[model samples]
Target chain A: MADSRAPDPTRRSERSRRAIYAAALALVTEVGYARTTVEAIAARAGVGKQTIYRWWPSKGAVLLEAFLDLADQAARAADGGAGLHGIPDTGDLAADLRLVLRATVDEMNDPAFDLPSRALAAEGIVDAELGAEFARKLLEPQLQLYVKRLRAGQEAGDVRRDIDVRVALELLVGPLAHRWLMRTLPLTHAYADAVADLALYGLAPRP
Target chain B: MADSRAPDPTRRSERSRRAIYAAALALVTEVGYARTTVEAIAARAGVGKQTIYRWWPSKGAVLLEAFLDLADQAARAADGGAGLHGIPDTGDLAADLRLVLRATVDEMNDPAFDLPSRALAAEGIVDAELGAEFARKLLEPQLQLYVKRLRAGQEAGDVRRDIDVRVALELLVGPLAHRWLMRTLPLTHAYADAVADLALYGLAPRP
Candidate 1:
């Protein structure tokens, strides 16, 4: 018979994993990506290096997973614990995109997401391998939600059938990313709405 | 009287300036922005460290000037020495934009611009001060060119007067920058044309 006071091995491991992720995110935010080493993360996490090595192959892998987890938490919070099912679709493509982009602006403004995400993004810019992995693992999945919605829109006769949904999505995403990354202008709800409207209706005057 | 065979002091100064620019770009590419120092740039440039101190206040300042010169060189080469007056105004907004964006795709493909620019961009992402400085100094000027062109477009009835040209330009620029920065896909001439087309025409089926 197990002792009532004994710490469960499964629960302990889960706590260690969460600790490792917190350490990774905190270290990356404080010192940036290149300087946030496995040794530092393990030390900060109060876990043995072997434990981290057993779960993740490299620091990049750890940070990627950490970021994914953070995004999941934010999504869950936003969707009332539903998780990131997909962007909401209410048949109006313009309204739906505006709603989503507004939420994106809110996320970009959040320091919890902003600082660590910037650190990872900074590294990904110079490190092509990491950048590609990030785009594939993190960005591409989120982008696919837009693709799914646009495909649905095509079926509903909202989006033009000839439009390449993939490239079309970039019109909205690119401006936001550019504004956010470059820090050229304030990333605001109004800006998001303008981007959605411009991308949907275009710069040319409606006939 | 000046020695007849001796190098002109002005010409010698110009050569030294060019050499400094080359070294700054090269060092940053080889060692990255964080590690690239003014002393190292001077050593690589074959000049005294005092010479660098006499010019730029910081390494960031030196890199900024160097990148500006590199962009000027690329532009002059493209326009056959006409210099970067502005984006070409052929009156046909679509064709003009297509031609310019295609050239941009070619520029992004150039390794000379690719390597060093990536280093600076990586640093900018996490370092908000540097990011803001680079944007104000380098990016905003280039963007202003688009603002000018779009203003002309509005007058010619190619673009809507109500459209915010500042944000409108991002639809073309954001996608290219996102693709180039993230290396998400093969940025091609065809892709540039698609971005331009989708931007000019509303995504919704035209009535």
Candidate 2:
């Protein structure tokens, strides 16, 4: 009888998915990953538990997808439709990096992003399987963007050809990650720009 | 009573203190910070729960002090009586940094150090209060060693006078921390040496 009165299953599924993502993020932020449960998420999301289970194999998977969705939304908002894919290639590598880093500072500071991200990141630190999954699914792809840009710079002769782009990207991003995660200093655009300059120009006095 | 029979209370207290620290480290590594309890630590140390409470205010305090003790032990073991209290003043800053970083690689890879340290670090990532305590108690003092060395270099006309020693030190340590925490690559002595060289010499070709 319920199947006969079809009210667009696809739309209903999409709605359920968004609600589940919201519930999952909120639960993790509030109670932390150790305590957050799929059943609780489904209850808060006002959907059947089987609905969430159908889409994600576990709570970790749900959270990961939720974060990806949030990132996508934030990226779209920042670029007005450019989305969260790669840094813009504006010919000048330093300027491009600066722009991206500035955006990153904003994202990192955003409460919508900050609270849930910290919860997930903190969970990942302790759970080796979860941490590896998070790194593989989320972090590595974003890092690949830097690899692509650095390769472009290498071809352009802006970066040294002998340098490993992977390691070099760490120099660019590591300090910011350290500061952001540890809250050692203010995560500001100026700070990001300064990091970019130091990494690009080298700390030694130009001969 | 055994408490009244002590020839030297200070010596007896020191033994108990060491036992508590050892128990804290082992408990955290096995059960993690969330499940680790003062009672558990006390039990494992073969001391009363009241003994732990009398000496330390909280589980976090006990863990922090234990970690500090562990770090001091590792440093003393690495540098003998001199300890890792100061960066070596070998006149050549790059070479000195390389020597310390190589030791760090060894320390980070050691299981006795790595397991408990990772557990503590993982807890700190999510627990802001604990993380701040770790920085204030442990990481900052270690970092100041680099600051002193950089200041010496500035006096020697090797480092630029205008550079912020704190930020500059990050340029050297941040990349290494990133690689180690993320498990992106093998953290080797060669890798450490390269980080020191690149940070000191810069990525650009020397003119």
Candidate 3:
């Protein structure tokens, strides 16, 4: 596999792609999504508009790719040298969830991620096609990481067998999303821990 | 208290106000929040823009009031000869939550409520100040009812004493909100019941 790839043209193209992604994200965040144009992004990235058009069909497509790149960078940064996409399965589900959620708390609080995310999320809420595209491309993939972790727990006999992994993951994720979107309260380590505990043990007393 | 109220003019003003609210909701649903104007609403209602201004401060204010009225109507309709806003206790927290959530599913699915509400929600997502105001005035009050019910559960020992009522309510509300906002899957009675079960009992098997 390593010998099958040549680095010359690919490396140069990768650098250009990174610049374009950076420019797209910055422009959308700086100005609103409605105001962002292809020419503007190309100008910011020092690329021709034809180059952007050649790569992506529309401004939304550019923004979607930009978000995907941003999320990947965030995931790598968050891996903390583990290079894992999900909570570490240390044979302790609760502890693993807490560790991941604490990191998520930190991430959600980061200004670099939060501002542009909020702007994009706000626009997505109004635009159905955009929102659906975001879900398919960015949000669903991140959520699938949770689904994988939950399935692992289920197989390990930690999670209940009857539970739907998809919906069950929502119990773990939904509260945090709601808090972040609504700005109802501060998203903190304490809050994350509480959500994890509640999600694990539930509100009802164990029989 | 009932006998000391003002007479016919107050009643007439109330009617016009209701008409104006209806008009505003219809216009927003049809034209979307951005294109929706006070002039359009007034024209739709067969009233003057000055009349709308005399009573309300801005288009956001008008939309807010319109939503409040719509919610009241929904609540009254759902109440169905019962008291408004309290989830049925029946000494069963899970069942009560499921019942309330099912009603919410119905309300969310209702075309009359869904269209305008979605329009407003879409606009609110993009507009921070407006979103905050709407959440504070309309959404928060509705959520507080859940808080009160949950606190009652705590007092009755049905709910855990340690769980934050505010956050715990999100465990109940968040999944539903996520499903509605994202359209990730079908929102059904069975789904609502499952969420309540998971929220109350958690994903982990009982030890």
Candidate 4:
């Protein structure tokens, strides 16, 4: 007779994957990108070094995946664990943009998200190859959400038809990112509202 | 009689200051923030370690001053050595902004400014105290120039009186910075022109 308590291989693999991601994010935040090593990550994750090597080719790969995972978690949490599939199409472009931006402000302030993301972003500034990869894999996808929402707004006549959605989305996202990274000023809901208003209506006085 | 060949103290001090700035920038780019040291900067500048410490408390201080100096050099060069004291206050706000932003695009593309500034900015992202210091010393001063220009625009009724000049300035500066730092898109003169138009005229259609 065989024992009935054997764990499933798929479940075991997933557990290991989550552990590795946690370890990667934590280690990078604590020691920074330059000093974080695969061996160290493996040790912290309670996995053998070969297991990490088998799954990821380099530390950058591990860190990028970890960040993607963290972002998903943050997004899901913001959307009440329903999963943030896309920007909500409430038909009110201003309200939708403001909602998403406020969520972003909260995420930026969360220490769990803030510290590690800053580490990855900081490394990305100096590391061109890694930066491009993260931009493609992580940053672009996030920006695309705004693009999708803006395009939807244009279709619904909430946004101007002639607006280049891509560049227009930058007006929504860029100021917040600049202020957060540079720490120039507080990133607040009020600030987000101001950006949305300015982007939508503009700064020129109406006749 | 006093020896006429002896170096003037003022001239010697200015020469040493420039040399130290060059040395600090180069070392940070080569070895990164954590590894770049006072001793190394002193050695590269051909000054005693005491000379560096006499002026700066740490590598952070030295690097901040170096960046401010580099920015001054770039600005002076852009203005044909006249020294850039502030943004030009031409009656046409859009035209004046376009001129300054184009110059900024050129500066961002230049390697001498790009590499060292990235090094310092990368460090600031992870190091809070240093980030705040640099923001106060270097970034804020640069931003204040935009603030002054915007205020001028407001007075001239080019910008809406109700708009916050500080926030309005971000719409001008933020997108360029976001594109340049994240490498999300090509930072071009045309792009800057679009941002200025979008910011000034609003993204929505006029009635």
lDDT of 3 at B52: 95
TM-score, cand. 2: 0.90
Top model number, lDDT: 1
Residues A35-87 of candidate 3: C-alpha lDDT, one tens digit per residue: 88999989999889998998899888888988877766665566575433566
TM-score of chain B of 1: 0.94
Docking class for candidate 2:
acceptable
lDDT of candidate 4 over B61-170, digit per residue (tens):
88888888899888776656645588888699989888788778777888898898888889889999888888998999999998899888888998899988899888
Candidate 4 lDDT over residue span A1-207, tens digit each: 776878789989999999999999999999988889999999999999999999999888888889989998887776666455788888888888888888888789889889999999998899988788888899999999989998888787777887798998888888899998899999999998999888888877767
**Native-to-model Cα distance after best TM-score fit, residue A185 in candidate 3, in Å:** 1.4
Q: What is candidate 2's CA lDDT for residue A18?
A: 96
Q: For model 1 chain A, give the 10-residue run with minimal summed lDDT.
A: A75-84
In candidate 4, which residue pairs clash?
A: none
Query: What is the DockQ for all candidates, taken in turn?
Result: 0.82, 0.48, 0.50, 0.73
* Candidate 3 DockQ, CA atoms: 0.50
In the range A1-207, model 1's lDDT, one tens digit per residue, is 867887789999999999999999999999988789999999999999999999999998998899999877766665556456698889889999998888777778888888898888888888888899999999898889899999999999999999899989999899999998988999999999999999998888878
Q: Which DockQ value does candidate 1 get? A: 0.82
Q: Candidate 2, residues A122-154: lDDT per residue as tens digits?
A: 777667777778888888888888999989988
Please list the residue runs of candidate 2 whose C-alpha ends up more than 4 Å from where it truly belongs after superposition.
A1-8, A78-81, B1-8, B78-81, B205-207
**Predicted structure 1: lDDT:** 0.88
| Model 2: per-residue Cα lDDT over B55-144, one tens digit each | 889998898889888887777766655576788998988788898887777777777777888888777777878888788888888889
lDDT of each: 0.88, 0.82, 0.81, 0.87
